[model samples]
Target: MALAPRHLISLSDLDDGVLDEVLELSARLKRRTGRGELAGKTIGMLFFRGSLRTRASLETAVLQLGGSVVNLTAMSDFWELEEREGSVMDGRAPEHIKDAAAVLSRYVHALAIRPAPLGNSWDVDRRDERIRAWAKYATVPVMNMESSLWHPLQALADVLTLKERLGDPRGKELAITWVHSPTPASPSAVHSLLHAALRFGMRVRLAHPAGFELDGGVLSEAEDLARASGGTLRRELSLEEAVRGARVVYARSWQSLETYGNPTLTASQRSRHIGWRIDEKLLASGQDAYLMHAMPVRRNVEVTDEVLDGPRSLLYEQAANRLPTQMALLVNLLR
Candidate 1:
């Protein structure tokens, strides 16, 4: 009998105490570097899509903690994987997810996966079938760099950034607004933040267009947490309403689940809200509002260069926090 290995698949996966511990450790690691706790460890990173921050940050984090990494692009480095339960192997993809995951687990101390959400099945993709398939078969702990539905590592960094800037995240007016993007983005980041904010008892104001709302299940859970934590998680259709007097204005844009898998429709839906882009006017709502984006932004579209380079923006710090934050996560999981 052995203790089950820990996996961070979602922010919701971390309880309040564990989240607090991770944030505190992240702060410490940022102030004073880690002790190379994973001197002999190896991390196998598989990306189903392209990434700059997630991969580089994790690679750096592993090395800083004295661990090595094996980077693999699923679509290029190896055979394409089939995630279905029982599928005939006659197509281009040769390897099944089960075999790929189980074998990878044997070769590395831990497995981290970032999968794309491009598929016709909202039901399957929304539930993150590929990541789940890997987790089901892998022998070692599985961490999510980013999945179809969530990005816990990014969310964790965001919380660290907020705590560092605000000192105390509780009882603060936090605005989570939606901006425009060329393509529909994943709602997981905003969802993850809402979960963290509510758990910290912050006043969370989610502002998005009519069809750009977040997942109902995530919202429901956050609402419950808010009630219990003495915080509020309410939706606001107007950005002004959401950011007014807020301490932090997190500008984000997510795909319209209503038109998921339909690019034309989703694009059309997103186009109507181009004015939703965050500019200086929006920042005026909270002069000291710490502008935050998840990165890989569509500058001048989702956010203006003015706001991004302004004194209040935490973009660079937010990005830098990813390294130490992930170092904390790896040390906690792999140490």
Candidate 2:
């Protein structure tokens, strides 16, 4: 990218000013919609993993902005693009990310990429080698739909949900609590949640088991943002304590970093956390907190039907905001 083209690689990629501007733009576009300024623009949508909302929201967002999408999904048209440095081309993968990235940059006005199939290697997974390679080589602006490290699009919707519900996010009591799940999950949503909250100076309480702490680097960033915003960030062991008197309770599940990228160990660790499910009883422990989650949730696993289907649940609104939030972002990049 020349002198830094805009890329939503992570929440940090966009400063608070720009991010909040995007949110405002999203709200405006949602109310009125595009003027078709980007009618002939095309965005390359490459999904190395399966997606429901991200794929649909992005394509729809582009279309709404009068831009089209060239979609690519893994296994169907997606193939392995080697990302390693100076690797021999004798492996099963025939193409390199550099060449593929160059082509993608040339064809589309901008590009959005999802995570590729991750192997058993925890080290490789955390590195996000594939997306990094794409960003390094692609001249066009890159968008991160979701990656092993973060899910910024979901996080943007989350902040939009919070803003829509709470008015101003500044100084609000927000709690991010870990809940039960069928499998170990990525920390993407949680990461973005903290970044968004702290960016706006919201008091953020993070509750999780001993093994389920977030990445240290990401935690440090949240701490810095909180400090800068005059917001407080507390890591609490008690779920009830974390949500106490909070306005919003973000219930989500993430793989334990202690056993991160290790399925067997992650399962073993969460086995002790079966009681961590979020429900009415838990939400009531707080001050009539609004419940939020980036779904499709394992209803009974992460939360009971009552809480998920209840009035406090903001899941659908959050899902709905994904469309406009992405539409604003697409226009920003394409224009």
Query: Which ranges of candidate 1 are over 4 A from the true structure?
Result: none
Mind sharing the TM-score for model 2?
0.96
Q: Give the clash count for each candidate.
A: 0, 0
Question: If scored against the real structure, what TM-score would every candidate get?
Answer: 0.96, 0.96
Q: Relative to the unseen true structure, what is the C-alpha lDDT of residue 230 in candidate 2, on a scale of 0 to 100?
A: 93
Model 2 has an lDDT value of 0.85
lDDT of 2 by residue, 1-335 (tens): 35666777888888767787789998887789778957989999998877998888888888887888899987799687888879999998889989998888888899899976374665667677778788888888999888877888999899888999999989999989999887646888788889888888898999998888888888888888888889999995578888779999998898877776577877888999898888788888777799998987898889999998999999999998999898877766655
Clash pairs detected, candidate 1: none
**Candidate 2: where are CA atoms >4 Å away?**
1-4, 117-123
